[model samples]
Target: MKKKIVLAYSGGLDTSVLLSWIKETYDAEVIAFCANIGQDDELKGLNAKAKKTGALKIYVDDLQEEFAKDFIFPMMQAGAIYEGQYFLGTSIARPLIAKRMVEIAKAEGATAIGHGATGKGNDQVRFELTTAALAPDLEIIAPWRDERFRTQFPGRAEMIAYCEEKKIPIQASAKKPFSMDRNLLHISYEAGILEDPWFNAGDVKYRDYFTTLSVFPEDAPDKAEYVVLDFDKGNCVAVNSKPMNPLQVMKALNKLGGKHGVGRVDMVENRFVGMKSRGVYETPGGAILHFAHRQIESLTMDREVMHLRDSLIPEYAKLVYNGFWYAPERLALQALVTESQKNVSGTVRVKLYKGGIHAAGRQSQFSLYNPHIATMEADPTKAYNQDDATGFIHLNGLRLRVNSQVNGPANIGG
Candidate 1:
């Protein structure tokens, strides 16, 4: 019996060629799997295309709800942002796709899983690490890392020529300036023209290259728009008083945020692969949700718990970005993060204006923000005693006073 390989196929130029190449090179039957995590029209005609490209069968699963609920929501709750700017839109999607790919491999009795992610990129780590964590025995076939494959297709031009020779239908051309990966959470652009870190997307010559889910801030509406998000246990449950499931919440927010150009990030980030790469992303809905989630957290979460979780944000973000979603450390951090959100049920009103997200108001049934205790006016209720602060300050400053005396007044200004 021929060995079977389940390939992560996107029906894009790289994967289109990969599907055919894997079958011919390995002398194996290739099964194509595409996870439909909010790709919208990108999922169209993939089944036919995959089979025509030599796939024995194709599995295109609709994973949007699972993506939003199981993947995107938990990441948001943990406030996992890569390098403090990236929302981890692309990073978070990898584990879910790889998880499904592993399942398909097991179900089909395939001995290996294949991906088109280049060896130089983070997705290669993300996809392979996920497979390693889940199913260590299954072999991972990365064509881009294969010397024979690289030799044959040195660049996009070669790939296109190979496609034409094979009579494989592909929409890619040499003139295309960048590559994009879009799921429901975001659309990320990198490579090609984006490889130049100094290239300005705002320039009139290149203005049209970067946007998909959002308009440029300069093109947004003149007036600010207000959006109210309702959360239960840190999950966004509604938008503007309309109850919605996780999927609906994302869709609604994406539309609102896109209109105001709320989530466009262009940054150079250190990839887990030990290289800095430039990435441009549009995460309209995610920005609104992250801001609103933090606002709600501020109103409801305990002080110490919030601080502790905040300290773990960078570590958690690194694990996710580096493809350790199923690792024990990440799971342990997730447990703590989940506990911190128990009281984080609330509503947050946000103002969106030309790429800015502002927390206008936030309220919760479990709100810890006591306005009466915080007020400066005469406190007839005496909710907080002003006299107690004098003693508290004195005790806290005792060490400082002793250090100053012993150190000869700390040599002010040297």
Candidate 2:
């Protein structure tokens, strides 16, 4: 009996060609698995395409809810944003896809797991590291890194020719100006024309080509849109007073945010693979959620706790971006993040307009914001005692006063 190999398939040109190559090279039966992370119509005919390309069986799992609730929510709670710009859209989705692929591989009793990620990109690391953490014994077949595969198909033209000769269908047209990766959270465009740091990705023609979830800022409506989001323990549970599941909340936000041109980001980011890559992202819903989550935190979270979490954002974001989602360090960090969200339940009203989302107002049952104490109006009974500030200020400034005395007031100018 031929060995069975489970493949992480997308029905794209690379995976299509890879399906045939794996069969021919290893003399193995190929089972293609496609994880449906809300890519809409992209997976419509994926099964037929995979079978036509020589997959003996195909698995398409609808993981949109899991993607939003499990992956996206936790990252949001942790405030994980790569380099202060990227929301880690493509990076966050890979581990889930890889985890599902590994599950299918085990169920099918496959001897090997295969993926179409190239040698130089971050996806390869994400996929392989996930497998290593989950099933280290299973052989990982990465065609782009395989010497035999590289030698046989030197470039994309040769690969396309091979696909044509083998009667396999391909979706790639002439070299695209940029590459795209889309999931429920966002759509990202990178490489090709975007490889040049100075390239204006927002040029009318290019922006239209790459944008999926949002319009250009200038094209957004003249009037602002107000939407209210409800959070339960840091996860958004409702929008505009209507309760929704995780996926529903994200979808509704996407519609509203896209109309307002909310969540468009362009940046040069450092890839885990040791390269600085330029990327443009449209994360309409995610941007709103992040903003609202922060707003809610301001009312409910303790100031010192918020500051500590803020300090850890870079590390938490790094783990997700670097393909360490299943690593012990990330798991430990998530434990702390989860604990921090215990009192983050609240409603946040957001004002959305061209390329911006602002937290208009926020309220929570556990709110630490005591307006009475914060009010400017003085209490005749001296509730806060303004006279107390004199001693408080003197105590806080003792170090400065001591330093000035020791150095002498005249020498302080030096």
Please count the clashing residue pairs in each candidate, in the order shown: 0, 0
lDDT of 1 by residue, 1-414 (tens): 999999999898999999989999999999999999988899899988998898999999999999999999999999889888999999999999999999999999999999999988899999999999999999999999999999999977998988899988889655668889998889999888889999886554555887689888888999999999999999999999999999999999999999999899999999888899998999999999999999999999999999999999999999999999999999999999999999999899999999999989999999998877788888777888989999999999999999988886766684
Model 1 global lDDT (CA atoms, 0 to 1): 0.92
| Candidate 2, RMSD to the unseen true structure | 2.1
**Off by more than 4 A, model 1:** 411-414
* Candidate 1 weakest lDDT stretch, 10 residues: 202-211
Which residue pairs in candidate 2 have backbone atoms (N, alpha carbon, C) closer than 3 angstroms, thus clashing? none
Error of 2 at 263 (Å): 0.6
Best by lDDT: 1
**Residue-wise lDDT of candidate 2 within 1-414, one digit each (tens)?**
999999998888888999999988999999999999978888989989999999999999999999988999999999889999999999999999999988988899997899998888999999989999999988999999999999998988998899889999886589888888899999999888888989988877666685688898888899999999999999999999999998998899888989988899989989888988889999999999999999999999999999999999999999999899999999999999999999999899999988889879999999998776778886655568878999999999998889889986645354
Question: What local lDDT does model 2 show for residue 266?
Answer: 89
Candidate 2 error regions (>4 Å): 379-383, 400-414
Specify the highest-TM-score model's number.
1
Candidate 2: 10-residue stretch with minimal lDDT: 405-414
